[model samples]
Target: MELKTIEELNQIGFEKIGEWKINKRGALDYEITTDKTTEVLYSFVKVDNQKEEIIYIGKTIRTIINRLNGYKKPGNSQFTNIRINKEILNLLKSDLNVNIYLFKCNDVITYKSHNINLAAGLEDTLIKYFKPKYNLHGNQRIIDDVELSENLIKLTNDMNDDKNCQNHYLIEKTTTVSNLEGKINLGNVPFSFLPEYGEIINIYLGDIVLQANFINGNNNGGNNPRINCVAIGNWLRENGINVNDNFYIKICNNNSFYFSINKIY
Candidate 1:
């Protein structure tokens, strides 16, 4: 059914179909389906550690119940559904909540969605507007991303060429010491994208800023510079990233490096 409001002025007999939650705790292993003959549905899922966040927003031609139930089954031919649901199941296995929500739509409602092409078009619009994580497939609102790129000049040091370059060196004898906050390790960490050593690396962490030097290489050319864990840990700590967690040291420009935090294991 197309979305419609019960407009008094238009004399349309529109009633909003409602979604009720199903407790999946007991029958998680079983196939699930819907009670209603729903034509359109919106699913809202909250992955673990994100109780406040609806990590994914989705719409389906099937009823909300049947669609969410499809995740538990194997041999799904839709590659995107299979791929994204794997992530969802992982989150669920880790004791994270995958709360499925839906918006109800029915055929007998005596009103029409004004000027909208209806179901599929509305779904696309909702996906773009919400920017949900799991809707990686389908049409995207590239305008927002393009505008962001326009605002920030492209940082050009692509790591592929840097990785294969002869100038890349892995310096040794580096150590990580533990502080009250956490620990740093003794390892040869490479900031492969940096072109020069002993140069200032400015890391902006919210209101706090951390600065470190890219120590020059001791090789014959003495060209490859690196910033170790001691510097990295401190910078991450200031920015709320743990030292033990996997993170990347990205050199965006000469004066700045972006430290991206990844998962612990």
Candidate 2:
């Protein structure tokens, strides 16, 4: 027999039609009068406004349907009726407004045998090919990649022991001059040290270093200690420096200061 039209079948509410055939395995094999069973497998709802989207694809199987709805308490069944039930429920709740298409079969093979096996094989192939979002097994490769990136970031962060040290110092002051002159700039410092200083100081000092000029401020003078404590504090926090570490800021000139981060790691 020829396969029934999709529109016609949907109008009849898939359950009332009883014309089907049973194969040797007691599985239902609907005889398609017009198209082959493979064609019916190709028909599926395109999801997410995709021109080539194929959400769900499967051949009509009487045994599969009977097994799904046969028992009021299907929880004890060997087959994965629970998963199948969820899949159907998800489809009904989907925002894409997808419709299910039923193909009437004229043959019924023995249950759990060749016909059922063929239907299952076809289902697996379709699941792999289209990768429906609702299907849990579908799109596994992409999901694995996403999961891997998250794991890597978590692992790297976990390796850092002193990640929350707030009062860390970045620049160590080791030298002092009675009469110091010229520009001081911290921008020439290594990129690794840039994180030690808060983002603002890093930007300012980095710019100064790049220009080869030091920021000569009133904080360091001939009589007073020539250390930019504010800049050092910013650097410490940025680099995860701890307050317990003793360090000093070395003034390179009026425009820049050398930041030394105390190692607590």
Candidate 3:
């Protein structure tokens, strides 16, 4: 399980699935030739010229495309999804190419009349050996990459709360000067009523969508729930959203939400 380089992956039969990238508008772009519906153990590698670096390794029973979609449009509670999406977007913005490789375990072993998932079993071992920089050790620390901040690794346990995934919830808030400055306080809103801490939510202002991170105030006991969205601050300022402007967030049936400025203020 001492996987050191990308060459080891190809030598061990991992197939290159596709090259993934996001457009300027942050849309997913890739050409996948493998079966899109099968479970897989995959890796994300960045290719610069002839150099290759494995950034992540993960196994998913939900197929490659579905998992990629999750990374592309992460939910409010999906810290890893949000983190990886940001990493991918930043790298793409710098013109780095990320490629994906998939491995399907056809060699099955049965134990006690139950089929063993080789892909699942091998994931940890490979991660331990390869130690992809983005892979976290039980949400505590990055496996190989130590540069990530400790606070970032300490995200909420309920990372991807997708319950009632199809229901649209309305979250209304009035814009304050503080909100327009990027720190939005969910005044008097119960913690249980909003997305969990460390969640990344998509807020729409007209046709534009801004991704924001939900967090607690100076005290971490959900004392004051707030959202951190620098983009929203710029958008609000640019669009004449001032103090006392009313805005409402409409959580969509999908993994996104939209907001409208009731009063342009």
lDDT of 2 at 265: 24
Q: Which residue pairs clash within candidate 1?
A: 176-184, 176-185, 198-214
Which numbered prediction scores highest in lDDT against the true structure? 3
Q: What's the CA error at residue 159 for candidate 1, in Å?
A: 39
Candidate 1 residues 40-103, lDDT tens each?
Answer: 4354455445343445544443445555554444222234345655776566566765554444
Taking the tens digit of each residue's C-alpha lDDT, what string does model 3 give over 109-228? 777666666765566568777667777562443222122221212223322235634545666677777778776676554322455334455555565444554554533111355666
TM-score of 3: 0.53
User: Stretches of candidate 2 above 4 Å error?
Assistant: 1-53, 58-79, 90-96, 103-121, 136-265
Model 1, stretches more than 4 Å misplaced?
A: 1-34, 47-50, 107-119, 138-265
Candidates by TM-score, descending order: 3, 1, 2
lDDT, model 3, position 260: 61
> 2 or 3, which is superior by TM-score?
3
Better of 1 and 2 by TM-score: 1
The superposed Cα distance between candidate 3 and the true structure at residue 105, in angstroms, equals 1.7
